[model samples]
Target: MGAVSKEPTRFTVEANASGAARYALGDRADFADVERGLIARFDEIKNERGETVLDASTFSFIRQGEDAPAGVDASLWRQSQLVIQLGLYKVVDHLFQVRGNGANLTIVDAPEGLVVIDCMEGVEMAAQAMRLFREHVNDKPVVAVIYTHTHFDHYGGVKAVVDEADVESGEVALVGPGTVESFNKYALGENVIVGNAMSRRASYTFEALIPHGVSGAVTQGIGPGGGSHFTTTYIAPNDSITATGETRTFGGWEFEFLYAPDTEAPEEMHIWIPAINAVTCAENANHTMHNIQTLRGARTRDARNFARYLDETLVRWGDRVEVHFGPHTWPVWGNANVVAFLESQRDLYKYMHDQTLRLANQGYHPIEIAEMVQLPDAIGKKWFNRYYHGSLHHNVRAVFAKELGTWDGDPASIWPLPPAENARRYVSLLGRDAILAEGTRAISEGDYRWAVQILHHLVFADPADAQAKELQADAYEQLGYQQEAPQWRGIFLTAAQELREGAATEGGLNTASSETILAMPMDQLFDFAAIHVVGERAADVDLRIGIVVNDTDERWTAWVRDGVMNARPQESQNVQATITGPKQAVVAVLLDPSRAGDLVSSGVLTIDGDESVLASYGSVLEDFDPHFNLVTP
Candidate 1:
């Protein structure tokens, strides 16, 4: 493999006055000021199909795909401009949008040898960034990549960052949490049971298509508020470390890895650079409060664990840290400032966790606490006040799920009817007209919280109610404008825009890579299944089997224990089937469902037992829960 450290690619960084002004506020996104500005801006806008116009002057970027050139749509172009500029931090102008992880990018400063953290969604963007990073040394090379967590935004594209020959022949070092095999589950259940709504819901949540000002805009999107969509691949860690105080050096940089698994992600960790006084918390700590439950849905994150991870990070590196950069937003420089930022992040989750549990102890249901959850003046005043990923409403559900479980304590809610059935019954009890009238009144009175609840019933009761849809859209529109969290702002605004218009047909959404999948082991993949697979599907079939990969002499068993799918490595057993093939080959086919058939045809797949079971097994699993409401009563 030609994984040589080349002469560094040289590049320059210049200040973008517009980006400087907007992001310079650091994390203090003033909601009152933001809201008023947006309301006035909204009056001048139009919801044109897929485009939600941002600022015209700033909404332009280098077009790299089949989509229209930047600025064809003011919103998309400007957002792309913002996404590209803000995400890259203007660190590399030559290196533009890669695997679009919004602001997330993977740059290899050759002089530094290799320093990549989170490859956005596009390979080209990563490639561009690599070039920019290389420019510094003129001949240095990328030696290692650090995937902070298993989330797609964290690391999705590898081919663009490193050559394939280097990955296969062992030229680069891949680092992250969980076993190397845990990351693949991100793309596993794509076909047969597609979460088409995820990209839709993602667009709804990210508001990538919306205008940036008040009415149409909100905080940015989530993760890196990531952009681009590309196939992902990962190089297995040439070295592995999975605990606190784990330090290792690659190329010239020293990394101290802190395992933050089970907090933000099932398999996640943070890296600290003692030399630069920089700490990459990955997805653990971000500008705004992250989702306890994401829209491209998975199981709710543990609030206590989420806060605890931040606390641990501060304890370990609070003194040495000079700058605090994350998967998103501007970095906080100075020891005192960094401590303050991390403390706010920690307290935000801590308060949510402590307060929510306190409410739950008071016998409050998920809905009650979510509606009531608020921060004191200190915490609420921070720039991260916006609910981007982990909105206030849904995080309460996550809190309840943690303390009381998803059962909601009420027996009736335990075995709920189909939404349509409940909708019909509820509408029957209260005439549709009354609900609509009440919803309208709530909207006028600025009781948006009430309007959301009332209109929800109207839409569910009569999915065809135009007025209800319009008013709901209006309410969501207002909420979106008011939100300061990037993801929340994007989601609320996107939803409002959609209801007012129609479902925005997304441009092109990217997929992940096999390298990234191989980095994930079967066990982590199966765990991912537990999170993404819909409960309704699991309730039907009961399947237990073991898989033995002949190529590696590896045996894995998957069972329905306690109504949950569990899989782990074990001695080979004469159970269901022993599939034979290279793990990467099998993974490539498994990455996308519709592509599963390619395995059999390519002769890479060989099943011994019921061949039909593979189809059934795939069918039984569901895609990510995309339509979940981030802001609900």
Candidate 2:
């Protein structure tokens, strides 16, 4: 049977209305800045197959100059309107930005050539952005590309803006925060391990499958949506800015780099332009509160570092800089406005960090701290510091997790039963009908959070319980409707949708970029291989394998013993199997052992040992399921 959905509850409508009344919805400054210095709007962007990658017309449902609908938060609706104003805008002299294509591409018209900062999320969007720039602005060749951070959205479309041949020939320089190895470690390595799980979670956060309408995805907090369906490419940065205050001249423009490690990204930096009196904070300081820990999951960011970096930026150029822009959101023009913006952002993180730790020291649990702590009106009331992307609730929890860990000083919670087992126990104790009755009562009382919590056990206890799923989904929908943060809303709504329709069988965004995989170092590749070995399956197997990469002149000995796989540099004597090939061929075999014979027959790989050993090793390696159930057991 098909799932049934519910409309916004009366209580949810009243809550949203009350929340909307608190914000100055009539404010025009943000709107003015969003549409300021607009050159021309992009009509459409298409990939090679004539598929529309990005089209502003798709978001026509978001009617500008209108009040928030019943299904959306008022504040988030405002952000959605601003982000959906898709066009190439002039930020300041010699600076242009193409906004609303996943990430904004900042262009600098330099004396030598155009210097581009961040090239959207995919090649098609990047190409369209550059095309818009050329059509409305200038058409000078791109002499340099600056990657502000290690995020894929920041540098994925590198090939579209500049030629790899030019980069190789030194005609175009690729500048970034850290060395190529460091970039690969954070960008490629971090995601490749447990990538399927992260991608599954990210689908909810980004609302990848959600339709665009008042009842669906409005904005991706910082932008209209995630990257369009196009080729996501990456090119390692050739030039690394390793230190703070390090200066590099690109396209006749001098840029001072402030290496900000472990803030928004593990490898991230902010650029200071002396000539333009402008600074690009990368993803550090945006129009909204940034994530201390993203919902999609990664290493927890240092809130203290986030604050310190902003403070450093403010102290270093607060008075001098006339404008401040970022990869996401509109620019803050004028010295006073920029300074105020920096101070607010700096305080935003610092306050959250200090307060979260303060509560932690006082022995309050992370959840308790999140509920008790509230931002001062001076900081929270500001439009720039509003919870559009990151919320105080989650950031506070993230800060606590980073410092105090997830234990919360409770013995009972330390080694609790797993979710499904715990749910079954609860069902045995309370009975399913009683739990459902309580959940329905909570929903009727406008306690959606409590309703979802109680219904959670029922759903887990019996996945086929339609009443429990419906009640939980209804509660989730109401909660989603009231979230000011787009990500929070997306998570809740996506969960509700999945609970109603069952989890999607197809995978989310395919982040396994071939270029990124190829750029990965040997250690990372070995590490990835180790993760694929199923411990239980390998318990009885013991094997020694030698891998020799001809192109890189690298040798490694991989041994599987004691239900685990370990690899070290250099070969060991008397290996059971030895595989010699180029890095590409070796990588292909490692990723898909079934293709080993084909690669060997095609002369791409030479195996000089027991061939059956390869099969034994492959037998233990398990491929991760990309479409694993998230909202279900």
> Which candidate leads in lDDT?
2
Q: What does candidate 1's lDDT look like per residue over 1-633, in tens digits?
A: 012111111110011222223332332232221122111111111112423222323322233232322112222222233233332232222111222235456443433576677775545445555554445334456677777776565554556677657755667776767665443343333311234445555565665566543244323533223233334454454444567888877776677888887778777788787766778677767756788877655656887887788889889989888766666644455689779888888888888889999989888888888889888868865655445456677887787887778776777888898776776777889989898899889877767767887788878776667788788877775554344345655666666655665554444233323344365566655554555444666666666656656667777776553346777788546456555567766554333334546776788776667666566567655555333433221
Task: Give the clash count for each candidate.
Answer: 74, 0
The residue-level lDDT of candidate 2 at 522 comes to: 85
lDDT agreement of model 2 with the native: 0.86
Highest TM-score: which candidate?
Answer: 2
CA lDDT of every candidate: 0.57, 0.86
Q: After superposition, which runs of candidate 2 have C-alpha atoms over 4 Å from their true positions? A: 1-4
- TM-score, structure 2 vs. true: 0.97
lDDT of 2 by residue, 374-451 (tens): 999999989989888789999999999998887888899999999999999999999998999999999999999999
Q: Provide the RMSD of all predictions against the true structure, rounded to 1 decimal.
A: 11.3, 1.7
